[model samples]
Target: MEPNLILTALFLISAAFTVVTAEYVRPQPRKDLQFPWDPKPSSQPQQVHISLAGDKHMRVTWVTGDRSAPSIVEYGTSSGKYSSVTQGESTSYSYLMYKSGLIHHTIIGPLEHGTVYFYRCGGQGPEFQLKTPAAQFPITFAVAGDLGQTGWTKSTLDHIDRCLYDVHLLPGDLSYADYVQSRWDTFGELVQPLASARPWMVTQGNHEKESIPFFKDGFESYNSRWKMPYEESGSSSNLYYSFEVAGAHIIMLGSYTDYDEDSDQYRWLKADLSKVDRHKTPWLLVLFHVPWYNSNKAHQGEGDSMMAAIEPLLYAASVDIMFAGHVHAYERSKRVNSGKSDTCGAVHITIGDGGNREGLAQRYIHPSPEWSVFREASFGHGELKIVNSTHAFWTWHRNDDDEPVRSDQFWMTSLVSSGCVAERRHELRKILISP
Candidate 1:
C-alpha cells in the first residue's frame, strides 16, 4: 500500500469516529424570508449602544436612516456639560433589494474607572449615562441569548434593567431575524435601552449567518454591526474574541466558524488561553452560541463537534464555567470533562431562556442525562455576580411572575489545586450547592 493513501484512510476513519451518533445539520433558510422595512429617512440617531474598547475605553455605536447625517458624540463626566467631541464613521449594507440604515461607531477612551459619564450622539440627541467598572474584581454580568423582538423579550429586558448589571455577556443568536435583515433594526431598538447604558459584549450565532445572494460568505450584517474586541485580542476575525472585565478573562468562541485543530480559530484560542494570568483573573468563563453538553432535544449535538475540537484546551486551562444559548431553555451541568464528572472541569450552563419569537423549549428527551444538574423551561435571563476573586454567585431568573423569580442559584469557587485536590474540594467544601 502507498504511504500517502494509508495516511488519507487513517484521517477519514479518525473524522468518522468524532461525529455524534445522531446527525445534526442546519436546514437551508426559506427563499422569501424578507419583509418590507422601508421608512422615511431620519437624521436622528437611533439604536445606540456601547461595547468595551479596552479596560479604560468604551466604543459607542448608533444608526441613522440618512447617510448624510453627522456621526458625532458630545460627552463628559458631568451632566449637561460637553467637555470633548468625538467624530466617527458610518456604514450601510445592501442585501437582495433591501438597504439597511447607516451604522456608526466611535471609541471614547482615557476614562476613569467607577465613574459615570453622560453623552449624547448626533450633537442634539437626548442625554444618557454609563459607568465604567473599577480596575479590580467584583464585576457583575447579565447573560442570555436567542433574543428577538417579542413580549417575552420585553419582559426579560425589563428584568435585566432592574438588576442593574454592569455588563452583558451574549453567547449568540442575538436576533432571530436571520432571513429578514430589517428585523435587526427592531432588535437593536429593543435592546438599546439597556445596551446603551452598559457594554453588551456579543459573538455571532448561527442565526446571524444570513446568506447574501451575491456573496459566498454570510454574516455580512453581523460583521458590520456589533463589532467586538477581536482586534485588541490579537484576533483577525470578529466572529470570535476575548476580553477582560474586572477579575475575569471572558473567551467568546464562534460555533458557525471552523474549529478543526489546525483552524485559525483554534490557533487563536490556544494562544489566548496560554496568555491568561489566572492569578489576576481567577474566573475563566467561556461562551459561544451552541451547547456542547445540552440535554434539551431542540439543539442537541449542535455543540458536540465544537466541544470535541476545543474541550481539551478549556480543561487544560482550568476554565471555571462555560455559557451558551440556542436550546431555548435553561440547563446547568455539573463540573464535567471528557463526558464525565470531574471537580477541576468547567461547569457548563445553557441560558437560552431569553424570550424570542420562538417560545420556550419545553420537551426533554426521556431519561435525563447524568451531567445536567438543574434544568428549566421558561423565558428569562441569568445573572453572574463575581463577589471576589475566589467566589461568585450565579442565578437564573424566570419571567413568568410579576417579578423575577430565582429558578436556580449556586456559588462557584476557584480551586487552588489542579488534579485530585480539586476533586476533594468538590466533595468536602461544596459551599451552597444547588439541587
Candidate 2:
C-alpha cells in the first residue's frame, strides 16, 4: 500500500479503539430492571415533586440529564396509562465551573375540587410517580421552614413522611444554596419521597442568593427545574403570587424585593389584600422568606426592617396567619395587638427546624427575651393541620438522634373572623405596630 493509505488505516484503527473504550465506559443499563433511586446516571428523573397552586392547580418539577426529550406529564384517573399529556421544555443550570442536568416542569390547570389524580412526570423520555390529590378547597397542609441537607433533614423527612399532608409549604431557606450547589440535590432527593404524593410550595430565601452566574440564570437550574403557579392567579411574577386554597386566600411574599411601602410589591399586596373579603375566602394566610415577630438574636427584628413597608398592609388587610423561616430554631408568639389582640392580627409561627446545617438558635430578645413563647434547639419538622377556619393544629416533631418524636406541639387559633374586627383598623392589629 502507499504511504498515505497506511496512514489512513492507522487513523481508522485508533478511531475504532476510542469508540470501543467510550462504549465500555458508558454501558447502557437494562431498561426493564432500572432502579429510580440508584444514584447512577440515567435519563430517569430523581427529584420528582409537586407544588400546589392555591386550590385547583399543581406544579410538577423534576430533573434529567438528557435534554433531547420533552418534559411530559401523563395523567388520567389511574396510574396505568397517562391519557392526558402536558409537555414542557428542559433546560440546564450553568454553575460557576460546570453544567448539570436539565430541569423540567409542568403546571396542570384548574383540576376538580376533590378528585384523586394518578400521574407520573417526565417526558416521553423517563418518568415515575404515585397517585396524588389535586388542589382542593379548605385543604389542610403543613408549613415548615429552614430545611437544608443534614441528618436531621433525613429524620424530619421520615417523621413528616407519615403525616401525609395535602401540601408542604416552605417559607424559605430550602437547600441552603447560598454557599454551594450540591446540597440542592440532597434536598431534592429526600423531598421527592413526599412531594410526589403532595405539593411542596415555596418562597425564595436568602440562601438562594448566589453569585451573578447563578442568579443570572434566574437560578436557572433551580427555577427551571421546578414549576410554580404564577400565570393562573394573575401573578405578575413567580417571586410573588396569590392563590385561593380552601376557604383561605394565600399570598406568598418575596422579602428580597424593594418593599418600601411605595414600591410595586407593597402596592400589589395592598390591592390583593383589599379584595380578600371575609366571605369569599374567610381566612387569609400570608407566607414569606423571613419572619416579622421572631425573637432570635441572629434575625431579631430582621423582618422589622420591612414591617414599615409591608406589615401595615398585611395588618390592615388582617392577614389571618403569617409563617416564616430564616432562624434555625422554632418560635411561637402570644397573639398581640398587631398580633396580640383576639379581634385581629395573624398568629405568627417561626418553625424553622425543617433541617439545616446550622444547629439551633440559643439567644432571644431579652437576656433571652419574653417574645419567644416556645423555642427548642433540636432537629425537627412542623406539621400544620387546618382543622377549620377558626382553628389549626401546629405540631413539631423533633428528630433527635435520628429518632422521630413529637417534641413540641400546640393549637393555633385565629380570631380574624367577621365577628371579631369590624374594619381595617383594630387595636390588636395596632399593638405591635412600631410606636
Candidate 3:
C-alpha cells in the first residue's frame, strides 16, 4: 500500500475506536423525574421539621399553601390551652416549572431538656410533639445524603425511623431536585415524617447549587428554606456552621464553597476549632458532602484540593470522625491522615448510599488502599451513637431487604484526652512564659 493510503487507514481505525469508547463510557440517564403530586398545597401546615436552636431552644418549621397564613407556633409542655406562642418568618422559592408555597420557621425556647412538648403550627390541626435532647453524652445521630423520592429512599427512611436518633445530619444533596423545583416539595414531604421528630441539620452540596442562567446566586432555594443554626453558630454564611450535641462538637463544612486558606470558611473553621474545649465536648466530629479519603472510582480525588486546604487543621484539632456523602456508596476509612492510615487521625466514612435516583456506585478500583477499611455498593444510612466521651459506636445499615442489616459496624474511640489537652496548654504556657 502507498504511504498516504496507509496513513488514511490508521486515521479511520483511530476514529472508530474513539467512537466506540465514548459510547461505552457515557453515563446512563436517570429516570426519576418528579411528576405533579398535588397541584395545591393544603391550607393546613405541611412538611414540618425541627432544628436545634440553642441549649434551651428548638426551631419548628412547616409549609402551607396560604402564603398570608400566620406563621405562629403555639406550644407548651401540656397539650391544648397553649401557654406560649412564637411568631416566625415565611419565605417561598419560584422556579420556571413550579413555585413552592409558604415555608414557615418558628423558634421555640426556654424549655427543659429531655421533656416532650406538644406544638401546633399554622394556628391549628395535626399537632406535633418533639422532645428536646438530654444535655449529656450518649446521644445518637443519623446521617445520610443523596436521598431522592423513591421506594428505596422510603426504605432507608423506614430504617432510620427505627433507630430513633436525636438528630439527623444531612451533609447536603437533599431532595436532588436538580432544577425541577417541585421535587423539593415532594422531598420535603418524604423527609417530614422523620425530620419532624428529630433535628435535621444540613450543609450545602453541589446539587443544591442550582445555578440557572437568570438566577445564578446559587443555594437561594436551599438557603431560603432549610435555615440551619448558621447565625447561632457565628458562621457568616449559611453554607457552613458548627453545633454541639451532648459531648460532641460537630462542624459542618461546605464542599462547593471557596475553601482556600484565606477563604471565610477556613478562617471560621480555625476560629471554631480553636474555641473547642475538649474537656466539655470530648469527641470532635466533622461532616460535609464530599469525602476527602474516598477510595471509590466515581468521586476519586474529587476532594483532594479540599483535603489539602483543611486536613492540617483537622489533624491539629484531633477530629475523631468525619462523615461525608456524595459518592453514592459506602466506604469507611481506618483513621486516615493525608490519605494514609494513622492511629491518631480521624476516621473518614462515606455514607452517600441514601437510595437516590442515581443508583449505587458499583465500580471500585481494586487492591484497596491501606486507609480504606470497608467499602460497599448499596443504598443505606449511618448511625453514630456516642456511648461516652471516649468511646462511640458507628454502624451502617444497608436497605437491601426490608429489615435493617448492619453492613458495617465498629466502635470508634476518641484520642482526645485530658492529658493531650493539658500538654498543649502546657506548651502554650511555656511559650507565654518565654515571651
Candidate 4:
C-alpha cells in the first residue's frame, strides 16, 4: 500500500469508529413529534382506527409520527379488558405502498359471532395496545360525506356528537384536504370528538384528491392519520377495499381511477363480488365518492357516467344499496331497473350533506327523474342502522340538530326475494354471477 493511501485509510476508519461510538452511546428513537392534543409521550400511538373485515373478523389499524415499530393490536370482549393480541404487515408488492406513507393492516379473525370487542393499537414495552371498541352490537354508524372545516362543518360535527352514531364513515372528501393542509387539520379537529371514540373508516373523494400534497401522496395525511383494512381483502391499496360488519359485506371502491369496463378495478370488482357468499355475509353494500343514480344540479350526470361502466356488475351481483357523496346534497332513489322503477333494483342514497362551505344542496338537477323517492337540500350527516339478516333502516341526522329524521325507510325482510326481482324469490347466491 502506498504511504499516502495508508494515511487516508487510517483517517476514514477513525471517523467511522467515532460515529459508531457516538450512536451507540446515545441512539435516538425513530420519532418524537406528537399531535398537539396527545398528552402521552410524543412517541405514543395515534391515528388509531378499526375496520370490520367480516361477521366474525375485525381489522385494526393505526399510525405513528415516527416510523412505526412492530404493529400490535390488543383486543377482546368490549367492556372486558383487551386480552388477545394480533400482528400483521403489508406485502412487499403492496408494501412499496401508495406513497411515502406506510399503511399497516391487521385482521383479527375467529371473533365470536355477534360479539363486541374493545381494542387498542401501536407497539409494546412490557405492554402495548392501540385502539378500543364499544361493547355493543347493532353498531350504530354516523355516515357523512364531503365534510370540510367550515363553520357549518363545525356545526354539523357538533350536532352529530350530541347524538353521534356508533361509528363514523367519512367516505372521502374529508378536511377538504384538496384545498390545503391547514384545512385538513381543521377538519381533523372537527371530527376528533367522534373519531377518537370509535373507528373512522374513510375513502378518497375528489376534493380530497385535489390537495397538491395530498393528491401527490395518495392522501398520505388521511392514510397515515387513520388506519384501514386495505390489505386484508386483497385490495392492497386504500384506494379500494372491502370489509364485513355483522350481516354486511361492504365493498368500498375508488372513483379517481378509471372505472371503465376495461380497467383493473373493473376486473377486481368482478372478482370481489363473485367471492362474497350471500348466505354467509348477506347484505352487500357499495360506496364510492361519486354517485351512480344522483340527481343534483351542481354536478348532474357525472355519476351516471360511472354507472354506465360499473352498474352492470352491481345489478347482476345483487348489490343491495349504494352510497355516494359529491353533489353536496341529499337524494335517495326508490329503485330502478333499466332506468325505470323495479322492485328488486338497488336503492341509492346520496348523503353529501356534511358541512361544506357551499351550503345545503338546494337545487334539483334532474327534470322529474323516474327513480326519485326523496330529495333534500340540507346540511347534515346520516345514521345507518343494520340489524340481523332481515332488517336494516337508515335515517338522516341533520348536523344543525341531533334529530335523525327518518329520511327514507325501507325493509330488507323479503329483500332477497322481492328486492331481487319484482316477483321471483331467487335462491341465495353461492357465487353471484354478474348477470
Candidate 5:
C-alpha cells in the first residue's frame, strides 16, 4: 500500500480502538418514591419550601390540613426566637377527585443578606431555617431540572445539599406530577430539607401544563403551590418571571406559555431586558424548559419557534448564559446564536437530567455539531458560581460518581465585562428608548 493509504488505515484502527474503549454507564433503575399520607395535626405545616420574593423578602410556602389555619410566618435571625411576623394568604384548588390542602404563601423578610433566619409556619410544626443569599458576588446557584420524585432525584438532591449553594434554579419540570396532584405534595416534602434552607427559583415546563378541556386550566396546582414573584417583575403570569440575586439578574422564561412576539411573556421579557443594568448586575442569565439548541435526537426542534421569537432579544442583551431542561440529558453549547458559535452569544446549557421518572435521553445525532462543546446522557445537576462581576465558574456533577466529580467545568467571562457587546448595547439602548 502507498504511504498515504497506510496512514489512513492506521487512523481507522485508532478510531475503532477509541470507540471500543469508551466507558458507558447504563441508566439507573427508575423508582418513584411514594410518601404515605399519614394523618397529622391539622395545623402542622408540611411540604415547606422557600423562594426569593424580591431583593429583600423571602416567601415561605407550605401546606396545612386545617382549612382555616392562619397564613402567617414568624421569623428572626436567631433560632427559635420570633422577632418579626408577617401575614400572607392561603389558597386551595381541586383537580378532578383531588382537593388540595390549604396552601399557605407568606412573605417574611426585609431580611439581612447572607444571614440565617429561623422561622415557623402557621406558628406550628418543626422550625425551619433559611440563609439569605449575599447581596454581592461570590454567590452559587445549584441548577437542576425535571426533578421528579425518583431515586435519582434523591441522589441529585443529596449531592446538592452537600454544596454550599446560595440559591437553587430549576429551569422547569419541578414535580413531574403529570396531572397526579398527590405527587406535588410528595415532591415538596422530599425537597423541604434543602429547599427550606435556600431559595428555589423556578419556571414552568410542559408537564406543568395539566390542562383539561372545558373543565380545568393548566398550572392550577403549580401556580397556587409554587407562587413566584411574577408581579414584582411586572409579569402577568406566574409562568414567567425575573429575579435579581447577588449581582446576577436571572430571568426564568416559560416554555409552555405564549412566547410569540406579541405575547405577554415576550413583551415582559423585552421590557425586563431593557431595564437590565449591566453595570450593577454584570451576570445576566436566563432559564427555561426547552433548549433552543440541542444535539440529542429526543425532542429535537421543540424549541425552534420560541427561539425564533425571542432569541434575538436575548442575544441583543448579551445574556451570559442560558439554562434549560426537559431533554433528559446534559449538553453544553459553546456561545452560540442561530446555530453558529459567536463570541457575543450565550453559552446554552441543558441540564434536564435531574432524575425524572423518565429515563435518560441517550440517543444523540451522530457526528456532533460545532456548537455542542460537551454532551452526555446521565442523571446530573449543574452548579454555577458567579465569583465576581466579570468572572464565573460552572460545573456539571453526575449522580453516578462515587465522589463529587466535576465532569465538565470551565471559567466564563461576562460578555459585558469582556466588551463583546459594546456595539450591541448602544443599538439595544436606541431600540429601547425609540418610539
Candidate 6:
C-alpha cells in the first residue's frame, strides 16, 4: 500500500476509537454541607417549620437550645402587629450520646385560607410568615423526596421556592440523618425557609427508621419532631396518616411500618377510603417511600409485599395518583394495577430524586416495562397543579437545566370526574356478590 493510504487508514482508526470511547458523562454529585449550630442565645428559636394540623389549623414547630423556653407563638395578618396569641407544648429527647434541643409544637388558627400570617416562635426570634393553602380548587403541591443536606438538596429546594405551591408533599427519606441526631437539627434548619412558609406533609422512609436491636425503636426522633395529624385521621401511628387540603384527600403511608392486611395502617386506610366523599373532595392521592411500579434497578421489588396487601384497596377506591420514593431516581408509570396498564388504576410516580448525598440511581432495567411511562435518573422536584375538580397538570423539573425545564408533563383527569370511580365500584360490587 502507498504511504498516504497507510496514513489515512491510521487516522480513520483513531477517530473510530475516539468515538467508541466517548460516552455521556453525568454531573458529579454535590457534597453534603455541615450546618453547624451557631452560638446564639439559648432561648432563641431555630429550625422553624409548619405543618397541617386539622381543619383550618396549622402546626408551628421549632427548636430552642433552652429547654425552658416558652412554647408560644404570636401572630397577626401584618408583621410587627400583635393580634392573636397561642400557647403550645414542648418536649425533648435523647438518642445515644446526642441530646436534642427543646422541640415546641403549637397549633395556631382557625386561620383563614389563602392568607399569610406573620408569627414569632418562642415569643422571640425574627418574625416569620406562613401562607395557608387555599380552601378551593386550583391549588399546587411541590413534591420531592429523599432530600438530604447536600448542595443538590439546596438546588431542589430553591427551585421549589420559585414555584407558587400551596403545600409540599414528601414521600420520605427526609434528613438522611441515619442515626446521627444532630443532622436532624441541621436538616430542620436547612428546610426552614421553605417549610416555615408552607405546610410540609411527609411520610416515613427507611432512613428515618433508626432502630437498634435493643437500644432504641425506629422513628423515635422522627415521631417526636415531625408530627402529623394522625390522631385526627384516626390513625394510631404518625408513621402513616391522612389529611385533606384544597378539595383533595392525601394519604401518607408508612413503608417502614406494618402494612399487611391485618396491620393497623391497613385498617385505618380502609376506613379512611370508605369515609372519603368523592363529591366533596373530588381528588384522592396516596404517597409512600417504596415504589410499587419502578423500572429502576435500585431498590427493586422492595415494595411488592406492601403493594400486594394494599393495591386492591387503592384500585377499588380509584385513587387518582400515587407517589413513592427510595429508588434515588424519577419514574412515572401509566395507570396500572397488578403490573398491568388499566385506565381505572392509579398513576404511580416514583420521584425519589431530591438530591440525597447517596447519589442517584443511574441504572434502569432494560426492555422497559409497558406500564412505565417516563423514567430518568436526575436530581429534581415535581410540581402538581390541581387546576380543578376534574383536571390537573403534573410536571417534572430537572436541575441540570439552566432554566426550569418541563422535562416531563401531562394532563391528568380525576377518577371521580372521569367516571372511573363508578366503574371501579361496580366491578368491586360484582366481585363481592360473586365468589
Candidate 1, residues 139-161, lDDT tens digits: the string is 78999888777777777889999
Q: Using Cα atoms with residue i matched to residue i, what is each candidate's TM-score against the true structure?
A: 0.86, 0.81, 0.88, 0.73, 0.93, 0.92
lDDT of 3 at 430: 40
Per-model lDDT: 0.79, 0.64, 0.80, 0.61, 0.88, 0.88
Better of 1 and 5 by TM-score: 5
lDDT of 5 by residue, 30-125 (tens): 688867768889889999999999879999999998999999999998888999999999999997678899999999879999998999999778
Model 5, position 274, has a per-residue lDDT of 84
lDDT of 6: 0.88
Q: Write the per-residue lDDT of candidate 3 for residues 369-408, one digit (tens) a residue.
A: 9888998777889999998987898999987566688879
Residue 238, model 5: Cα distance from true site in angstroms: 0.4
lDDT of 6 at 301: 88
Clashing pairs in 4: 53-244, 119-131, 120-130, 120-131, 121-129, 121-130, 121-131, 140-166, 178-211, 344-419
* Candidate 6 residue spans exceeding 4 A from truth: 1-25, 426-435
What TM-score does structure 5 among the candidates reach? 0.93
- Stronger candidate by TM-score (1 vs 6): 6
Which portions of model 3 miss their true places by more than 4 Å? 1-42, 418-435
Regarding lDDT, does 3 or 4 come out ahead?
Answer: 3
- Whole-model alpha-carbon lDDT for candidate 4: 0.61
| CA lDDT for candidate 3 | 0.80
Prediction 6 TM-score vs. true: 0.92
Greater TM-score among 3 and 4 belongs to 3
- On a 0 to 100 scale, what is the lDDT of residue 253 in model 6? 95
Can you tell me which runs of candidate 2 are displaced by over 4 Å?
A: 1-42, 123-138, 213-221, 337-343, 367-371, 425-435
TM-score of 3: 0.88
Better of 4 and 5 by lDDT: 5
